[model samples]
Target: MKLVLVRHGETASNVRMVLDSLPPGPPLTDLGHEQANVLADALADEPVVAVCASTAVRAQQTAAPVAARHGMAVRVVEGVQEIFCGDLEGRSDREAYGVFVKTASEWADGRLDLTLPGGENGRQVVDRCLAAIERITEGVTGGTVVLVSHGGAIRLAGQALAPNVTASLAAGGLLPNTGRVVLERDGAGWRCTAWSGVDIVVD
Candidate 1:
């Protein structure tokens, strides 16, 4: 099985650098909708078998074009949304940057219990993402699938699953809007073949 993990397109909050992580989060910015179309175009030639999106509105919006192209309904999976920002939610983007880097570093250092004052720790967020992906992939035996998610959560989960290549990237949260990572299952295990292939190289 192959999994195409895609970060959702940009949102209104993204432009202003605000930390909006919960439900009914702002809709896709105009550019965000354009980015979503680009995502669909990028995967136009792949043998996509299923489509999944985080419960967040942004993710669902990102998955719309791709799901419609494949004629498959978007599967809104639980536990795969962005990490809750806690007290950081609704704060200015400039203010959230430091905490974002700090908490991410803590997670990389194996301090998964650390989180912002009101947010979820790395362990909680990564565990949910992993479980959500597992549930979706378990039923898939072949072909590619797409799971639209947030940048922070995807990289965190990537680090958890593929620490060697992802560690350095995870330390800084390198995924951009609509960034993509490809993972393939070989026998009984899974491995990342391409990570943020739009720019970053894995080999």
Candidate 2:
């Protein structure tokens, strides 16, 4: 099974520097829609069997075009959602961004117990995300699956599972919106097939 994990397009909260990870978080900005279209076009020929997205509004919006092209419904899976922001949900300060980046990095480094105030632990996020993917591609022998998720979730999980693939994606310790990585099922784990943005027009 091959899973293409994509980050949702940018939102107003993104520019505001706010940590908006919850559902109905923030709508995509105009540029974000354009980014989504580009992402869809990039995967137009990818034999996508199923399109899954986080419950967050932005993730759904990002996955809609791709699902439409393939005539598949966007499956809103629970485990693939963004990292919970907890007390830093509404902050737009550098401190908030710093903490977010640090937490994600730590999670990638295998700090499963780490989390923000009132937030979920790294183990919780990765286990659920992988479980959701496993359930979706349970019986599929060879096919592609598209997953629209958040930056934090994708960065930490993608890097953890596919270190070499996400190496370029680590820009100042954050992932660019709409960037995606392809992973193939390897035994009980995953292996990166294509690093994020190798053929992408945008970084």
TM-score of each: 0.93, 0.88
lDDT of 1 by residue, 92-159 (tens): 86657788778888887779999777889999998999988889898788899899998888888877
Q: Which regions in candidate 2 have their CA more than 4 angstroms from the true location?
A: 160-173, 199-203
Candidate 2, pairs of clashing residues: none
Clashes of each: 3, 0
Candidate with maximal lDDT: 1
lDDT of 2 at 69: 87
Which ten contiguous residues of candidate 2 have the minimum total lDDT?
Answer: 165-174
CA shift of 88, model 1, Å: 0.7
TM-score for candidate 1: 0.93
Using TM-score as the measure, the top candidate is 1
- Model 1, which residues run further than 4 Å from truth? 198-203
